[model samples]
Target: MPAIILDDISFSYSSSPLLDHVSLRVGDGERACLIGPNGCGKTTLLRIVTGRLLPDRGTVTCAGDAGPRLIPDTEGSGGSVGEYLDASLRPLRVLFTRFEEITARISEGGGDRLAREYDRLLAQMTARDVWSLDARVDETLAGLGLSELTGPGRGRSLGSLSPGQRGRLRLAATLLVRPETLILDEPTNHLDAGAVGFLARTVNHWHGPVLMASHDRAFIEDTATVTYDMDIDVWRALARAEGADEFTGLHRCAGNYSDYLEEKRRARARHSELHAAQQAEKRGLREHRQAGARIARGGVRLARAEGMAKKYFADRAAATATRRTRNDDRRLEDLSRQEVRKPRGYELSFPMNPVPVRPGSALSARRVAVRRRLASTSFDLARGEHLLVTGSNGAGKTTLLSWIATGKPPAGAQASGTIASDRPIGFVPQHLPRAGDPGFAEEIWLRGIGELGRGILHPSMWTVPVPELSAGNQRRAQLAMALAGRPPVLVIDEPTNYLDLDTMEALEEALHRWTGTLVVASHDRWLIDHWHGRGLHLEPA
Candidate 1:
């Protein structure tokens, strides 16, 4: 049997349906990736499979020997990173629990009765090498870049760690468990290039079933053997007899990330070629039919009286109208019978607005330092220059950005010496409250519609709540808000979060072309390697 099976599972929130009849199967030794825009129910699907959540309908089956384990993106459970990871080792837990029971029986003078049980448990722990749980936990923490948070003289409570650190902690915990099957949600969201690389090696070599939801192209390419794309459109129309619309469900592709990309490109090209051919065929048929009708009409005119022909008899007009209507109907029927699909993408194409940024120092930080992460360093960014900040998870990329965007230091970071910037900055951080008024997003998109193009926002989605949008759409909306004012310098944090590969590439290209200074905190390797920009590489303190 497959390691995990989800059969026609359905789930919903109060008034909105998130997933409909979702089904999936994952086998042992295969890492399957779930890729799509945000808000596509990837997290919910993982939860259902792990039995953390119950589907509104249908069932989930796990064929693994041990209970499945998961690493959720969001955080609420509390513990130090090390403690959390230690707790995930179930075999160790079993050993410890039995040890306590054995000690209690000894105290109660029932040692003989429990002696066999105690010896068996001890022997099992020794045989399985469960005593080194702490060592394995430490190793995982270091691999995930949580060493700073878990090492001696460090290790804050999970609540005190940043969101990114918490995500790393969860990942460490997941890896420590070594379950027969692993379920991970947005596993690459808060990781730096180093941590991502480390995790990629661990996952690629893991000999268990892995089901992961990720938007990182490189990570997916490195680890996944199969790709499952959740359907974007849940409102698919149904036949009149069916009454209600049903979801199109998960779209499966049997290849790695690169294969999926190549397949998509080929599909689009094939569609374009077929569409052109069909249009040409339709035009030829129409011309031939029209020519035949003209001949038939001419024959009718000749068959009529010579006197009537001179007047071009009224019946000739009626016959011409009838021919046109008949030809149009036949064309419609022929077109309907032809099976062809049009290519669809993000469908957004537009040039960035040109802004006359003053040619001078856009921003400068002299000997800037964050408490534990960013060391004192001086950097100058000139107008129209692009600055790429690179570092690990707990590094101070976000902290440094906040300092530049705002005049003061971020919460735990500090800036010293001289810092100067005359250019107005627009910053898009990793996290922002969803726009309260959906119309606000609508207004911004509308204002730039003439220059931004119509395909950026669908008319039907204008009124939907911003939080209801997929992650990619939310990023697009936030970008619209950031670009609404067209500031001279743009400071963005993790701009590629939750974005699909196509849109991510588009955004990177747009920033490359925008006529403004930019300071960005990003972990996307593709963006880093391809972007023609200056850099500040930070090492974790």
Candidate 2:
């Protein structure tokens, strides 16, 4: 039996439909990845499939008799990591509670009706190996490098931990559940490179199916057996408009993430070529039809010879022909069914032309640092060169970026070093304040929907209230805002945190072609390694 199945699922929030008659299935032992840009309804679709959210129309079925375990993107009803981890092992907790209850009933001289139930519960606990539950949990935590979550700092609230820590904690707890099938959402968001590697290996070795939605390219390459992409539908709709039959909906690409990209690229190119040919054919037909109309307009001799009403009947026939021409494309109806306009993809071009630099470095810092955060650092960055600052969580990577971007120490940091250059700097921070005014989305977006589509955040999300979008999309929005007015010196802190794979690739290309100085602070090994410029690795003191 399939691990999960969804048929004719349609879900909508507000007037815009997110998922329209979308159907998906994952078979036994199949690792299927649902990938699209942020807010493309991947999360919503996962929720529906996992039974966390019901579709307005359709049926979702899962073969997991005990129900599949879902690892949500966000932290659950907030608690200490220990409490959260413990809560995940609900069956174990229930077994302990039932055992205590049975003992109490027997001691109180309860009747045989209770005795029968008590005996059965005891046997159940033994069979399930409930006694080793705590040991399993401990082992899981240790394996995930999250033993500290249950150690001295176990009392720490989940929210207090860094995003990466909380994410690892969730993964550790979920793994302990030992569900037959797993539903993971953005599983790589907060994971560092090491944890991602562990997760990839673990998932690959698992016995059951794994359904995940993520924008992590490296993770997907390591883990996915197949990829499900809804964005193909959008592209198909474009092709269908041009009377294309080859590409029309969600595509399941075989192999891993890299293979998926290559396959999709080939398919898209082929579809475009077919569409172009169809457009030419349609144009010729229309021209031929126009010639027939011209003949009718000239008052054809046949009209008078056969007494045919050329003005009336011929015009009606021409109208019928035009209707047939318009309806010839069967897939155009797919584009007409949705209220949400498909976001258009655009090529983003940054406009920053800096004057020629002298023989000296573009930026030079003697010794400046964030107070109690970063050690006094010194580095000289030449013009048009790239620099990456890498460190683990709480290693003051952001602090270094801030100091360089502003050419002064951050508020809490002290500086004594002299940094050169008066070039304008574009700084994208790790955290972005939410756009509270909903109209802000409209104002900035209405002016740049085309450009917005070029980045990770789609243009369709522009009209929606900005506060409601994911943290990653919000971050992308800010980055878009920053890049709109490109500065000569670009400084970014963790630019890859919440972006989809395509957006990351696009930004990488942009950064490579930039003619100005660039400095980035990120845990994204792929991005950092690809830059291959200079490195500044920080270790916690």
Candidate 3:
């Protein structure tokens, strides 16, 4: 049975229609992904289906015997596990409280005997296995990697945990309830790659239906049996083939993302060719009347036949000559321009000194150790060099970047050292702050840049709010802000997170032109391969 269904759903925020009569259904145990460019309504659609936001028009229905039930959000509730569990099982809590009251009344006695009566009450509670509640809470906590949350007196607040940890805890609480349907929105955002993989595995093993909206391509590819690409194409063809509203099959490409792109290019080329052919036939039909008119006029008068024929032939010859001349002109122009100036790829390298003495190191680290959730490790970075830091999820790459930026020495530094240059430094963090009050954020960022007095700032940058800017533009703005400090060194973390291919390439070109020292932490293989720099490999200890 379908887990959830949307029939002719239409949603509009303000005057703009985000979804246009969209309809889709997810089946039991089906894993699906919703993908699209930013601002493409993926999140809005997810919210609508998850019942967080209501649709402007149309009906959303759920199948199976049980209908929709609200699942409580477990984060930042300032409630203990027991409290949450009790809230979830409110009817059971009420029944248990009634039983306790009845038992207390039955044990009513007098004097010192009342003390023994209290002990007897405690023994009765133990016999009734009331302590099992704590054990159950501990089990849930341990499963969610919150083993420290064990014990009734260990007053560990959920607020003390990081957002990622809280997110995990929320998922754990929901899973413990064993809901029939699950809807996750950008659940992987706060999770490391390892946690993402674990989530994918969990989804695959789940008996209930799963519907998720995510930007993480790997997670989608691993988990989704159906994918809805909003603002591009819906999977109606797959649904039709499956003989159901829900697609039961996964989209399997014979090769990688590049291969899929190549297939799309071929399909688009065929479509264009067919369109061009149809246009040519239409043009030929439109020109047919002129040719027939000339022929008819020539045939009507014999005296003018020879002259008309000559004129017709001359017209044809002139047209042919004109075509040839235009073709020749175009060919010559193409050849000339082809040889004129090809777009040169940027060449990035450290500035060379005339004397050519051994280039002094920009920064250096010796026997540096890093501590992360997954493991502990150490490494070194040399000056006048670029190093790619590569690792799997939970390998502490982000932590390392933070350590470098803060200038806090790494853990277990047997022979740790940091060499500083007179030049200033710039650091672009992985996550750009969300656009709230764009005017205020932009002004603050620009003022910081102005203080460095190192580079020219563009004036057009002020027009659009920071939130309105594209991801690539946001990263560029952050980079500009960092460079504004005129730091001799720059460290950028995950610079290509939301960037498209073209923007990613453009960023690489810009980075190549930069004269300052750079340290980049990224997972993009293309960025690593195109980078003309050394690499610092970190592994789990």
Candidate 4:
């Protein structure tokens, strides 16, 4: 049996239905990925599978009575690192204690039942490698780059750690728990290259099923065995129905991210061809019907003319019109019943507004440093130049960017820096500040994203609360707000965090052509590989 199964699941947050009869399954040793644009119910479907939120319709079934376990992306509350680690190993500890008790009872020769229980406990311990549990825990922490926290930093409070560190810590604990079935939501969101590689390896070697929702293309390609695209439109489904594949909500593709792309491309080509042919047929039928009507009118006019010749001509014309009308009506009915749906098209062009600034140094910084957070650094950015910042987690990428854009150090940290900018600077950080009453969605509509934004964010979502919006949508809205002012110098940290491939590619194209100075910090391997810019590498202080 499959480890997890979702059949005909339907869910909605309001009148706007998010998921409609979506279904998927993951068997033992299979790794499945959910991919789509932002706010397309990837997270929502995962939530349903994990039992965090119940579906409004349909049912979720697991191989066993227990449901799948989720590896959360954030540590919810404050605690010492040591306490959190101990909590993760609590299940093994309890089992060990039970094993000891059973052994004692068997030694006392209590009964046959006690002996049987001892054997069962022994088997469980061996399978889980309880004797080497400590070593396994240590290895997991090291692999996820959490060794420092488990060593000298273990006594520190979790609140002192950066967001990335906290997320890594949570991932480490989940790995140690070794749940039978694993479900992850954007597991690579806060991971660096090394951590992401570690996760991919773990998932590749997993004994049970794994399901994840991720925007990391490289990771998905590396680990996914089957891909489930959750953002299918009815029109797209209709187009696919013209061929062998037919689905309403979820479209399943075999193999990894690359295979999925190729299949989608071919499907789109077929849809376009079919749509064009259908359109031509419809046009021809309409013309024939109009011609029939004209003939009928001519017959009426001829019948009014005086004489036997006119009467005979009117009869012939009327018969011909009647025959044509019947044929046109039959063909039109057939065409209507078998009509092809128009394929959904994407308009991916996002042209940047011209920056109004004199040609010179756009930004200049000297010996910028935040105490205990960032190492001293300096750079000169000219107009139309792009600068890419590369670093591992906790290497002060965010600190450097905040300082560059605002010339102010982070809270509780002192900084010494000399910075100047000739024009206005726009900054889009990884974590945005608390949104106000109008919310990010409403703000985006008010400030208008032109043609490109509409493609990513549908008009129905304009009234959704900012907090209710998906992470990717929030990021898109933040970007739109920043671009509305048209700053000559733009600084963005981890701009591709929650953006899907479509939006990411569009943003890359816009940035490539924009005539402005750019300072970008990102850990996305795909983006870094394709970036055409000067590089600045940072190390942890």
Candidate 5:
């Protein structure tokens, strides 16, 4: 029997069906990935398989010695770690109840004292390891980089951790349970490069079956042994063979994502050509048949025949109109092809104003320290210059950006610095704010573009909402907002987090055109190599 199986599962939210009679089976120890565009029912299907949700039709079956274990949606269940664990172990409560019942029966007999002693012993046995629970919790926390997750020294609550950290914690919890099967949804959502790397390794080493849903192409390449493509028509199993490159494999005929996209374009082109030929042939046949019929009835000279001819002509015109409509549809389909580009970071620039030569320096830092490391650091950023800041995880890259923005150093650090610029400074941080903020999407974006003027806000901008905007558009909005002040310097941190290739190219072009000082912190190798900037490497202590 398969470890997990979905038999003719169908689900609908509202009038639209999300999963249309989809069926799939995953074998024990198999690692499969579910991939599709957003709102494609990947998450919904996962929920159904885990028993957290019931499908409108059909059933999900799990055949294993350990049975099924479902992980609830974090947002739906407001339960803490302890609460979740308790719920998971609820079956154990029945055994304890049975023990209590036995004790109750013994106490009713003549040997009341012995029954009381047995009751005491039973209670002690059941709770023998209760005191050590805290220790176990602490160990799990430490493994997830939450060493301070115990006692008064617990400086940060679980909620305070970054999304990446929270994801790690979830993984740790699952590992503790040692379940036979694991289902993950968008597991790489908030992870940085290093964290993603760590997770890739973890998944590769996992012994049990895994079914993950994600939009991150890179993560899917690294982790998925088999790929499942869910479409409106059917669920497909992509071919997987030896020596396959995750980015470009047999599941897809072309190669990587870009290659697959090109293939789609070619297919669309062929479809259009065939459709146009078919329409032309049908039109010709219809016209020929109409002319033949008119010739066959030519001898009729009555007024009724004239009227019938007019009606036949009208019907023929309507047939021609239908053919034209089909042709128009084919043409529209050809023109509507969407091109997929590779992921790339964005380029940002600030509006410039000529600044007089400063007597001292553009920027100076003296005796700077961050995170109990990078002791007594000092650096200067000159005008019209570019600098790259490099560091590992938790090396204070974000802390430095915060300090620059707020004019306050990180905890246990002090710095004296001066920033002089002729243009307004623009800064793009690593993480963007949540999309739930108020404003029509376009307005929020226009606001981000800042005071760069109405020219930057194109007429098409109004059509898209801010939260629904792509990563590149969001970065553009942030850039526009920063440039609104017209600062002379631009400070960017990890600017290319979720950008695609085209947007990154646009950013590079925009930056090349801008005449302002640039200060950036990034880990993108391509961006670092191509960008016309100096490097500032931050090594771990």
Candidate 6:
């Protein structure tokens, strides 16, 4: 039986529809991944599933105790750590109160309806194991690396926690709450390598259905049992048609991301073949009809010159032409009903051109430490060398990178260090600030790298504001703009955070080919596994 279902879900933000008659289902113990390019309505669909947003049409159903619980992209507002934990369990608290009420009503001589309600509530409680909720909470906290946040740390304000800590807290609370269906939107966004591995394990072993929207290819490949891809443009066109079916884009594939790619490739090839064949058939029919018309015209001219004997030949030729044309028209009508639409393809091209540098040590950091954030660290990077920083979340990778790239630590971070760099360095921080005066893409153009920027971004996006771009597109623009003036050194923090697989591959290739001194802090397993550079591993301070 399906644990979650969305039937005929149609939605629109403006005059144009984003999601139209989209239907999806996940059975008990199944894991489904929703993947698409940036701004393709993935977040919108996930919000609809979690009931955070309602669709213009369609119904959402979740089997079992409670509705789906979402691990959101952003954290909640002001609240103590303990208070947040308590609020997460409110659904369980409500169920417990209802159970008591139903029991009391039965004792007061209730009917069959009351007994059935009591039984249903009892099953829900049993499934959640409410008797051991406290112990489960402790286990969940520890598993997600939040054991310290409990006990003496529970009193800590949410504002005090780092962005990574806040993100993990949301994930832990959702896991401990144990809703009937679990839904996650970019769940691995703020996670480190170890934390993402833990998430994959927990999700793989989950008892209920799991539906997630993520650009983390490594995590999706590890945890997803089914892949739901909505990246195709044809699906949207079909959904907008007058008599479209409920499942406009039921492009569900079994297995992981790799399998989905292979299946989609084969399907696209078949669609192309069918379309090519239909075009050939139509062309042949048109040529044959024209040839018949030519024959009829010649026979008419011959008959007029010869008399009654050749008139019969002309009549016969005309009849044959009419029959041939009629047959071709019927064939064309049949082919129209089985027309095959072309598939959509996505591509990214990023070329980095680094400025020339003298051969020597490009940067050196001696005993660098940020107050309460980073421990003392020392490293030297040669000109044109590549260095990768590896660490768990909150282990100060971002803090260290900010110092190296900007010649200073992040705001409010007091640093004690000796960091020296002779050449200019281009930096793309984890969280980019707003672009003042010129738009983000426009900045790249002003730096005389408009051609390079065009490889990563569409020309139209050059005039758009930075805040209006999708996260993935924004990341692309950031990288393209960073290469402005061809800095001798480049520093990037979590470069793979919001990028789709294709764009990620393009960025990886560009990094490998670029002849620049590089420093990157990333938690992407796929990127890490493929890296062949020096590594700086950090432990939590």
Name the candidate that leads on lDDT: 6
lDDT of each: 0.69, 0.68, 0.57, 0.76, 0.56, 0.77
Cα-based lDDT at residue 44, candidate 4: 90
lDDT digits (tens) for residues 13-53 of candidate 2: 98888887777778877899998877788888877766778
Per TM-score, the best of the predicted structures is 4
Per residue, candidate 4 scores C-alpha lDDT tens digits across 1-541 of 4498988899999997899888788898889999888778998988788788999999997663221353333456667888877866677788899999988877777788888888887876774568888888778778887778756777888888888888778878777666667788888866768888999998898777888898898898899999998767633545444543445668888899889878777776777777788789879988988898778766556857778878777777778889998998898787666566787654333335474546788778888888778888898888878999998777889998887777667877887878787556777888853544122455544444443345345565555555666777767666655665677778889887767876776678777776778899988887888799898998887
Kindly report which residue pairs in candidate 4 clash with one another. none
After TM-score superposition, what is the CA distance of residue 203 in candidate 3 from its true location, in Å? Answer: 0.7
TM-score (all chains, Cα) for each model:
0.69, 0.72, 0.58, 0.77, 0.53, 0.72
Per-residue lDDT of candidate 1, residues 463-483 (tens digit) = 555666666666666666556
Following a full C-alpha superposition, what root-mean-square deviation does model 4 have from the true structure?
5.2
Question: After superposition, which runs of candidate 6 have C-alpha atoms over 4 Å from their true positions?
Answer: 67-84, 87-122, 152-170, 192-198, 234-247, 265-345, 352-386, 394-396, 399-425, 436-452, 465-467, 484-489, 512-518, 532-534
List of clashing residue pairs for candidate 6: none
lDDT by residue (tens digit), candidate 5, 162-234: 5665565566455444455777777666555655666667677656677777656566666776766553111
For residues 376-473, what per-residue lDDT tens digits would candidate 6 score against the true structure? 89999998899999987778999888788778777776878788985567888887535541234455433433444576777667656566767777
Ranking by lDDT: 6, 4, 1, 2, 3, 5
**Worst ten-residue run, lDDT, model 6?**
234-243
Task: Report the CA-based lDDT of candidate 3 relative to the real structure.
Answer: 0.57
Residue 96, candidate 5: Cα error in Å is: 16
